[model samples]
Target: MDPENAASPPAGITREDLFERVWTTPINHLAEKLGMNHYQFARICEALNVPRPPAGYWQKKAVGKEAPRPELPAALPGDHARWSKGTRLLAPLPKRVYRRVERKAADRPQRPARHPMLIGVDESFRKTRTDEKNEFLRPYKYLLPDIVASADHLSTALDIANEIYNALDLKGHRVMFAPADQEMRRRHVDEQEVPRKDRKYGRYQTGSIWSPRRPTVTYVGSIPVGLVLTEMTERVTMRYLDGSYVREDSKLVRSARPWQLTHSWTTEQDLPCGRFRFVAYCPLANIEWSASWQETDAAGLKSLVPSIVARLHGSEAELQALIDAEEKAAAKRRKEWAEAQERYRRQEDRRAVEQALSHSKKQLAEIMEQWAAATAVERFFVEAEKRLEHLGEDRREHIQSRLALARAMLGEQDPLSYLADWLAPDERYQTRYPDH
Candidate 1:
């Protein structure tokens, strides 16, 4: 069948006929017969210019009252009375449902770490700056490049990273650089694909939605936990739609004003570096640990280490409990369903037995009625037997044959004996059926 014809209104039903049906039946009930939702059916009626009864129509009819249905307005010149077949109901697009994440309670105070990742790093600055591009740092090559940080920021970042690494390392975890492979990249909570040119930016390109990163991979045993980073200087961005640029010095600013005026432009100047923080996350466990981005300096980053460790263990326990509860509920539902099926089987068996007993009684009554009728005819022939001597031979033979047939119908014994058990009925009923 063509899809258009399937969805179109039934053929031969005019606009007036549709109006009568809508006013007579509830819209929801009518819509169901048409294989449509109430809203969709209403839209179809609107398109056809069909009028409907107002909301209280059914309630008024229930009380032996009438509700006035609206008069259908005239359709425009191109309007059609018959609905054209369109696509059947399309499923609604999926929506993301946000759920509140459960966090572990912060009840116990934790002890400070004894060994951090950066504990043995050399502190001396080199006369000529060199990139930290070795095999150990290879995974981070495209992401966190070895751009030289200011002497102070570098010291703070290193110290923060050391404390966070040690906190995990002491608990049988490892903090290493992220692997460059796609499989490892997918494990990061903030990982996403971007255009090729955006790959070198460490973050997704401007105008795209992505958070900043100072990439390092954390591991619990052999399992990779995604990007853990130490926060450095704060940068705020102002985005706009423009094809213009800005330069710094007074003369450069004056020169750029004309271009800015010609084309609306925006600027995103970095703010002064503030106290550093550290962020630790385990994407597999859906856990994130970080002190306030603005509040944590080198010392504060070390303090949060204990809390982060405690929460990781706590989250694992909670997740297990949730799984156990769901399994128990599923088992309970299965047990209840089995019990309901058993009850239905017993009820059906009882109904079959009751129906058989009722039918047996009806059969027995019909047999008894047939026997009584045959007995009445036999008595009539008994009286007429003496009078038959004076009759002709042919007439007497005809009367005798009918009397024999009446005797045969009554059978040799009491009617009840012949019908003692009707648990199973006879193979076939008599030619002349009993009324009941």
Candidate 2:
């Protein structure tokens, strides 16, 4: 087997055999061969009950100044005494060395102390740092459609945004895409302690005309979290200055401007691309925002993610408080609105009552006038009947007929009954306008 890619530890290498491997080569070189850093290799040696070659052991061997090999220490119960992932075994290995490694499985694998996301982000960032375009774990198209990046120049911005989203999603906050002017009743507490909503149609529009597409935004619940992506580039310019073919006429040469159209490179640059920055908006929490610049490397960028997530989590309490305040304000406004409706209804009822009262009074006056005129006519007819009785039966009969006609014309219909109905207030109206 090639020593560089040894298959595995041979079956039966013991502590003494492992020490021999270290003593044969400088500890640093041996560590490189094992693909482990010198410090890590040293720790592994301490764990494995193997004594590393002492300082200068390699130095003496290099100069042909020999020293006796140090005795290998006995394996203690806590000491790891196996050639495992970090060591190579000699060809003539004991069959039992493999058994030792198998028995020491507990010491072979050590889980990293940091989160996996942090590790992956660092690695990914490093690989793509020099890339002109952004890199994503998966194709950009697969992400939620509502996230429309500013332009192709900021294409990779979504990747960083996704990094933030994933962190929050893992923490149980559901991410939602918010359309422009969404209908959701978002309440804000005003100075008057009233809850007011600024809801509008969410469909995109320009100049009062509907637009099919609009800028994308993120939301958690009704609160909008704005995502802004900006790109900066460096630019350069060149200019040429020529004054070649001039005869050395001393007086003319002195007046000639030699610097005109000089050939040279003129370069101007804006902010460096290496310092890409992003911000996370927390609208619910006093419109709070947190921003981070991409770190110098993947590891730095990875380190930045946690703090951004922390800031977001830290604002949860404030967000809840703001929501509560808004709810209370809204409730108050609703109560006020209901009261105003009741007032308007009462005013309408009172107006109705006043109108009916005026109408009934007018109707009652007409009825009284008709009743008076009928009474006067009946009295006159009775008198005529008594006087005419002495004259003749024909005259008396005519008078009596006239009197009967008059009585029939004035039927028993009471104007007062009609007047009463017109005067009586409606119950529905009175309930709202009791005084009327």
lDDT of each: 0.48, 0.46
- lDDT tens readout by residue for model 1, 1-436: 3222233354634566667777777778767766779998786666556877777778888997866667878753223456534522212212323456566568854533323333323243222233321101112223331222334355555555556566666676555444322133322322111113222222222222122133455554344444344233333342332432332333545555465546554454332243443334433333333222223334465566677666553444454454456568768878989999866766665565556666777877787786687567556766878778888999999988876786688555455555664545333222122322
Candidate 2 least-lDDT 10 residues: 202-211
**Tens-digit per-residue lDDT, 185-237, candidate 2:** 22221111111343111111111111113222344433444433223222212
Which whole-number lDDT from 0 to 100 does residue 23 have in model 1?
Answer: 76
Instruction: List RMSD in Å for every model shown.
Output: 30.9, 26.6
Residue 268 of model 2 has an lDDT of: 24
Query: Highest TM-score: which candidate?
Result: 2
Those runs of model 1 whose alpha carbons end farther than 4 Å from true positions after fitting are 1-152, 177-182, 186-215, 219-224, 232-267, 284-299, 318-436
**TM-score of each model, in listed order:** 0.28, 0.39
